[model samples]
Target: MAAGAGQAPVVTNGIHTAGQPVELSIGLPHNLGTRIHLHLTILATSIIVFLSSATLDGAQAGAAMSSFIYAIPDRYNPSQPLTTSLYTQPSSQDFSARLAKVLVRRTGKLCYVGGSMNLANAVGGGTVDEEMEAFRAIVAVVAAEVTKARNAEE
Candidate 1:
C-alpha cells in the first residue's frame, strides 16, 4: 500500500522459509541523506533485526556494525522494558536500543534481538533530520510486520 500523507515511504522484501514468513527486509527512500535498510528474522520467541545503511546503488551493505542491543519485556510492567547493549565501537548509535524497546513494548514479545550499524555516508554522518527520518521509517515498517505476524497467528 502507498504511504499516507506525511509518511515516509518504505519498501519491503519478504523471504519465506518452508512456506513460513521467517524473514523480512526493507529499505527506506533512496533520496535520503543516509539510506537505511532493515532485515527482520521472526522467531517463535523473539524477533531479530539487522539495521544497516545502504550503498550508493541501494545495496544492503557498507555500514560497519557499531553495537548489538537486546530488550526484554518487564514482567511487572511490559511498557517499561529492560535494554542493554554491547558496543563494538565507541561511537555506537542508540537507535537500535530505541527500536528494541519500542518493539518489545508494542508487540509484548518476551525478547527482541536488534543491532545497528553506523549509518554510513560517503561524505560523513547523516544530519539529525535525516537520521530521524530513518528512525521513523524503521518504526513504521516494524509495526506493519507485527500486525502481519499477529494475523498469521489467528
Candidate 2:
C-alpha cells in the first residue's frame, strides 16, 4: 500500500506534519541482545578501522547520526519493518541541530555501554580462555578513543 494513503497513528511527542515526508525505520533499542550486541561490536570495529585519532570523536559521529533522521511520509512506526525513506525536501539546519542534540542525548547509554565493553575487551587479554582476545584489545583501544572523544563533548 502507498504511504500517505494509509492513516498514520497519532504520535504526541513528535507529530508528523500531515504533508511532510517520512521514513520508516526499526529503531535499534528493540533488538534482542544478540542483534544489539553484534551491532555494537560491529560499530566498535568500524570505529577502530576508520578512526586514526586517540579520542572519541563524539561531535563528528553524533552529528552524522543526527543528520540521518530527517525525512518523508508519516507511515513510520518504530515497531515495524524498515521502510524506504519518503523525501520531500532537505531539512533546515535548525532542524538538524535539534535532531543532532536529540541524537547525542539518546546515544548516552549506548555510547556508555560500547565504551564499557571496549574496556572489558582491552583488559581481558588478546585471547580469552573463552573468547577472542584480539577483539578485546581492539575494543579497549577504541574505548579509550571514544572516552577521549566523549569527554571532549563535555
Candidate 3:
C-alpha cells in the first residue's frame, strides 16, 4: 500500500514466544531503505539485550530469543518479501554464549552495517542520521517488550 505523504513507516509489534523465537515485521516507506538498516540495527541490539537479561538456560535462551526480521514488500507488493533469519548456535557451542555473539556480529553485518548493500538499496532510502535516530527509538521499544516478556515468564 502506498504511504500517505509525510507518513512514517509502519512497524508491527514484535511477537515473542516462550519456547520459540521472536519475529518482527516492519513496513518500509517508499524510498527509505535506510529505515530498514535502522530496523535491523535495532533488532540486533534488542536481541543482545534479550539474551543477556533472560534467565533461561543458555542454549534454551538462544533458541527462544532467536529473531526473524521481515520487511514489507515495496509498494506493498507481496511477490517480493525481504526477510533475514537470525539463528542461535546449537547446544554444543559453549553454552550458546558463543552463538549469541556470533548472531550479534552476523546480524550487525547483514542488517545494521553495510553487509547487504544491494538488499538495503532495494528496500528504501533515507539519511544515516535519520536512520540512527529511528534505530534508537526502535531499540527502546524492543528492549521494553523483551523485559515484559521475561517478566511474564517468571
Candidate 4:
C-alpha cells in the first residue's frame, strides 16, 4: 500500500510454503533527517514451517531474525552519518527489538540493499543458514565500509 506524503511506503506480500502462510511487510520512511527508518514484519501460520529448519526454536529464531532487521540502518550507512535506529518484528508473540548502531562514513554516495524480494526467497526454507546468509549479503557492503572506518580510526 502507498504511504501518504512525508510518510514511508508500505509493501505487503505473502506466499505459501510447505502448507504454511508466510506474510511479510516492509516500510520505508522518508525524510527522517540523518536517520532512516525501516520496519519489517514476518507472520506465518506455523512459524516453524515458515522459517524452514532454523536452528533455534520459534522464540530464539524470532529474536535472531529480529536482530537482523534492527541492524539494517547501520549496515546501510549514508555518508558520514552518525547514528542509525532500527525497529523490527520477526514474528508474532509481540516479539520485537530496537537497535541503534554507530557509524562513520568515508564516501559521499549512499548504499542500500535493493530487491527485498530476496528476503522472501530466504523465508521459504526458513533455514538458519539461508536466512543468515541473506541477511549477511544485505549488509556485506556496509559491513566492509564500517570495518574500513574502524580501521582508519585505529
Candidate 5:
C-alpha cells in the first residue's frame, strides 16, 4: 500500500528502518531445464550459476515483484545445454519471492534471485523450521518442473 506513497518504516523488535528499491538477480552455470532435472530425483549433478536475491509474493500471497533470470553454459561444453538462472523480484516486499511462483508457472522453470528478507517481521514468530520448509517447497517445485521436462522429452 506504500507504493508511490511515503516509504513506511518496517519495524521489528523495537527496530525501525526504511528500505529503498534495489535490483535483484541470480545466475546459474546450467540451464533451467537441467537444474530442474537434477533437482527432480535429487540426482548428483553440478550446475553453476550466480543467483540473485529478490522478493515477490505470489498471487496466493499478497505482494508481487519483477525480476530477471539468466544462464551461461560452462565455457567448456556449448553443445550440452544452456546454463540458466532466475531472478525472483526486486522489491522490499516480503512476498516478492512467492510472486516468483507466478513467473515459474509462466516460464515453467526454476529461477534464482538474491535479496535480503525483512528480518523485522521474520524475527517474530519465524523459525528456522519455517524457512527450511519454504526452501523444501521451492525444491519440490523445481523437481516437479524437471519431471515435466522429462515427460516432455519422452
Candidate 6:
C-alpha cells in the first residue's frame, strides 16, 4: 500500500508464505534531483534495488549497466559490511558499493544494488554532485521503508 499524502509511495507487490506481503516497490518523488529512478524491491529474504538515470524529460534511460554490488551486514561491524562486485567494475565502482553497504548496515539484510549512471553533460546524465545527492536520498528512503516494514513484522 501507499503512504499518506506528501510521502513516498511504497507499494506491496508480493506475499510471503505466512500470508503477509513481503515485497515492496518504492518510487521516490520526482522532485529529487538528478532525474534518477530508484526501484527498491524488498523480497522476503533480501533487498534488490534497480537504479537508473533518466534523461531530463524522464522519457529515456540515460546510462548503461556497468556494475553490480552486493552486501551482507557484518555482525561485528555494521558500518563495514562485506561488499563485493558481482559484475563489471566501472571506474565509478564505489558508488554502488557504498550504497549497498549503507543499505545493508541500516536494514541488516542482504542488498543487491545495480544501476547505470554517468556524469552530467550536454547529452544527458547528472553531475557527480547531483548523483551523490540522489544516492544519499535513495539510501535514506530505502532504509526507512525497509526498517518500517521489518518493524511492522515484529
For each candidate in turn, the TM-score is 0.74, 0.21, 0.32, 0.24, 0.29, 0.69
Return the candidate ranking by TM-score, descending.
1, 6, 3, 5, 4, 2
Alpha-carbon RMSD, candidate 6: 4.7
Could you tell me the TM-score of candidate 1? 0.74
Select the stronger candidate by TM-score from 2 and 3. Answer: 3
**After superposition on all CA atoms, how large is the RMSD of candidate 1?**
3.6
Clashing pairs in 6: 120-126
Top of the candidates by lDDT: 6
Quantify all predictions' global Cα lDDT against the true fold: 0.62, 0.24, 0.34, 0.27, 0.30, 0.65
Give me the displacement of residue 142 in model 6, in angstroms.
0.4
Question: Please, what are the lDDT tens digits per residue for candidate 5 over residues 28-102?
Answer: 111111111111121122111122222222112322333434333333653332323355444432233443443
RMSD of 4: 17.4
- Candidate 1 per-residue lDDT, tens place, 20-136, comes to 443333344543344555667666667777766654655445445566777898999766999877554446536667777888887777444444545555234566666666666
Who wins the TM-score comparison? 1
Candidate 5 is scored at a TM of 0.29
Report the Cα lDDT for residue 15, model 6.
41
Root mean square deviation (Cα) for candidate 3:
17.1
By lDDT, the better pick of 2 and 5 is 5
Q: Give me candidate 3's TM-score against the actual structure.
A: 0.32
Q: Local error of candidate 5 at 76, Å?
A: 4.7
Tell me the spans in candidate 2 whose CA falls farther than 4 Å from its real position. 1-131
